[model samples]
Target chain A: MSSVAVIDYGMGNLHSIAKALQHADSSVAVRISADADVILAADRVVFPGVGAMRDCMQALNETGLAETIKTVAASKPLLGICLGMQAMLSDSEEGGITRCLNLFDGHVKRFAEGLADTEGNRLKIPHMGWNQVHYKPHPLWFNIPQDSRFYFVHSYYAAPDDAEVTVATSNYPQAFSCALAKNNIFAVQFHPEKSQTVGLQLLQNFLHWDGAL
Target chain B: MSLAKRIIPCLDVDNGRVVKGVKFVDIRDAGDPVEIARRYDREGADEITFLDITATHHNRDTMAHVVEQVAGEVFIPLTVGGGIRTLEDIRRMLNAGADKVGINSAAVFNPEFVRQAAEKFGSQCIVVAIDAKKVSAEGEKNRWEIFTHGGRKATGINAVEWAVRMQNYGAGEILLTSMDRDGTKSGFDLLLTRAISEAVSIPVIASGGVGNLEHLAEGIISGKADAVLAASIFHFAEYSIAQAKQYMQARGIEVRL
Candidate 1:
């Protein structure tokens, strides 16, 4: 009876992610919690978030789950999704320059104002909808195909200082790090729960992963 | 690759069952909302919109149940609309697992509701659905007028102007449906769609008359819609979602295939 704890820091779609995890593997026990003891006891930890980075950082600090998450990242397999992925970086330019968890050596940057494709049409800001991901060899990409489409809805992207931690890259107009992998930590800018088949495969892979470097 | 143009299949649920009709009249039973949603999810639908047509108090609970069931089965983004009057109602729908909540009549009656919802919840989860009809009068240039109450009552608000107002009020997306073209199956109201899409910076979903794959493509290529939402053509199995994606892909519109 493997258990996975989804850290709920008063942000993100905790329900959908919990349901997706259960849907990926019905046998795994999934729990959404903010308590440190419950999160620490789980075999794996998933940190998911939506909304602004300032609020997310405020909630994480207020709930004291920030320390718990850092402790879990040291020993167990830890996964972050969307804003959760951004929060793992050093800081973000959103909400008037907010500092983040700094779990990974990266900073979150807002998409430049006048971004456009090769055709020179003004691209929409949020960068909403499906985009393909180019990945390198990693446990999370075990069964998923190369250049698989995943759902993304964000105005900011993660720019890791050390390119070695980047596991996958996606492009809106220019390429950006979409997935980051280091030791027992894995994070993605796309919403795997909203992403259809390939997303479920990634969650299934995370469920079976052993938190290896 | 750019963000693929989305093709969304909408389910008009009444008392937990999906229903379809012409201009909100002569309704016919489609199927279980959950079942239809699951089928569409398997068929590669980019997103799903569940509009609860029932206005009764008891049915609100049933609508929530329907959303929960569909959300459990379908992993894509789900937008639930109809009878959402207050922040509590929006909270209920979202708590039931809906990713986005669409506001129409309530938004027209009280424009502040749009701002409040967008402020409480992130703008990304707030969608304003506009029902519009082409208005032609002597001397005045033709413009679309906004309609409410399931397209039964007409509001004097201009469609393009209202779309801009909604965006100013912090709405992330606009779902525009042409009352005249709805159920006619001729095609989407291209002029109305293009006007609103071009007017607002946010994404706009072209709804109403969608008879074929070409119409869907036209909504994106010509109308500049970020997404297309249809009911009857998909409800009757006249065309599968995969076929639509293939059609759009062959025509060089990026679609998830």
Candidate 2:
């Protein structure tokens, strides 16, 4: 059976993603491992995280998983989730200019304070709850429909330098990059494990995707 | 489209089973938290909240199991409230696959606990549940006070001010429950909801006293809450999560269909 390694650098939803992946496909074995060699040996890689960007980077660097992630991003089918997605960017403004993995050409920015919707209701920060994703064609999206709502809980969003790299966008007060795709790597700012049926479907798609353009 | 206001079906769990009676006539067991959670998830619930009212230490273990089971298959965000007093407690719930944990009385007793939990676990997972009651005279400037122990004890802290304090302390969201109207089935105290919602920069989930579908809509339009949480109305089959979303959509509020 094929297997995937969920890089566990001691931050974010480790057990949840592993279980969701197995639930998404029983044929695939999901392992949450920090060992660089064990992770690189897997068929695919899933980098998931929650919490602040700074602490996440600290753990990844200290555990030597940061180098492991860069190697995987360039070599195989890789999925980055939430803070994991943010860390793929060049740098994040969170915790005062924390350097990310720089896997993608983008910068993470915090949502401006006192933002409101068309109805003028003050939009809250951290952007918690469900939001619709307007996605472009990608193998990862598969059967997930356009404008499908996904769960989001973050204070900052990715601002990719190249518009072509952004595969999906969601609105808080303005359109922002919520999903990105490049050769061998697919990243999302939403939690597919926590997104219910459509989320599971996305995981299944990733399990089957061969990372070809 | 923009972010949709969330409609969450809250379950009061005790000893691992749903405390409140559920009216799912076709489901095998109405009291099973996992079953009810699955039902709600299928009905398009934006999120599911389990208000663990279990008091005994051993029974709390059962709730953890319940969360684990639900988190494995249910997929949507799950928040466990009640008796989450320590970092260890928060860690246990998160390890069990809970997306977040709600802190209530513990936040009132030691405000520092909220700060510590936020730092240790991240504010995104630390939800400060504020139970508030109207304390001012009918004609005077409206003011509400925080209550604890299921609204039986007053903390003498102002609700709006406390919301700001929690936000400053790094609470990601405020699960504000209006104790005055919790079970009244009348409606949410819109005054209380808007006050705290505006005071805090984080998301506010308006809870308590949701009698009908319109009350849920009212929560967003009038209360300015980012989300609405209800127990009896959803628990008793008064409305399904899909129907509530449609109602909010009709009222021109964005909701997941």
Candidate 3:
């Protein structure tokens, strides 16, 4: 049995994400402690958030979950959603410059420059809505459709320092990375739980992935 | 590349139950907000909004409790609205785990609340919801007017202008609902939607008039909205968020397919 510990850092909506994973037949547990034992025990870990990057980073630091999370991600599957995903970056410009989990070699940037379409049309910020992902070849894409829709709601986006880590991309003004995967670490800018069938299928795929089987 | 459009599911809560409909006809009773939200999450909704339609000048606690339940259960971002008249209301919602707090009639009545909440909670935490309707006169072109109180009270303010003003007040997002198209499922009000989208710098979630996936695509691509917000369609099982997104993807709307 693969036990997945959902990190509870006193931020984020953890119930809904847990329900989705539970629906996919994975044993879901909400883990809030920074203890090394609890994290090392889980077969997988989920970091979920819906607040500013600064506070999320602070919670992890205050609770010492930051170090524990990194250690857990080294051996088991780790997932980040929304702010959780954003925190995985090297740093974020939200509420002034702040350090991030730095799990992936990337930085979170605001949509300072207006997004221009390929034909030069201006697109607004806080990218909210259902967008398609041009899935890049990765282990997380296993058992998932070539092109699937995921739900996104955010003003800032992640720009990975390493292009090879980008697992999926979406177009809004221009193509931007929507999903990133490196070994057992994976993060999606979009919310798979809110995504419907394609979203649910993606969760199922992750549950049964077995790290590329 | 064009940014992808989003699919959002909204719930109208009255006394802690999900109640919805234009003019609120044939109100279908649903389960707890947390349960309904989880189902939507499992079904792959991009985001969720809880409109506390029962909100009035008093009774903010009920709405806060509902938000607390939904927030505690749902892992995705949750936006809560209704009866948010002051900065305190916004604070309660955020404390209860709301990713964003939406202001409607109150924003029209007290514009300062928008700025105050945004300043205290950050602009991203504030969302201004506008209910729009077309007023017509004999032999005259129809005009858009803003409505509040769950589409009960009509404000003299222009929908587009209000949207622009709300953004200036630090609204991170706008939830624009078309009263005429709501529950009709005919599709979104493209003209009004585009006008608001064009005027605001924040992301716009076009609500009302979403009957099918094509509507979702048109609501985003044609209306140029950041996301499409629908209720009856997704709630009544007319279509799941996945089907709608797939349809939008086929139409080249850049959905998460």
Preferred candidate (lDDT higher): 1 or 3: 1
User: Which residues of candidate 1, in runs, are more than 4 Å off?
Assistant: B21-30, B136-142
Best by DockQ: 2
- Can you write out model 2's per-residue Cα lDDT over B1-257, one digit (the tens) per residue? 78889999999988888877665976789899999999998899998999888656887788889999998888888899989888888998899989899998999999999999999889899889999999999899999999887889888999999999999999999999999999999999999999998888899999989999999999999999999999998888988888898889999998888
Candidate that scores best on TM-score: 2
Candidate 1 per-residue lDDT over residues B30-134, each given as its tens digit: 467876777788889999998888857787899989888877767889889888899999888888888889999989989999999987877878899999998
Ranked by lDDT, the better of candidates 2 and 3 is: 2
Cα lDDT tens digits, model 3, B104-207, are 87788899988887766667678898999987665776568998766778888888888988998888899999998987879999988988887787888899
Tens-digit lDDT track for model 1 on A1-213? Answer: 999999988774578888889999999999999999999999999999888899999999999988998998889999999999999999999999999999898789999866666665567667788899999999899889999999988889999999999999998888999999999999999988899889989999999999885
Candidate 2's TM-score on the B chain: 0.98
**lDDT at residue B188 of model 1 (Cα atoms):** 95
Superposed by TM-score, candidate 1 places the C-alpha of residue B7 at a distance from the truth, in angstroms, of 0.7
Fnat (0 to 1) per candidate: 0.45, 0.92, 0.42
lDDT of the candidates, in the order given: 0.88, 0.91, 0.76
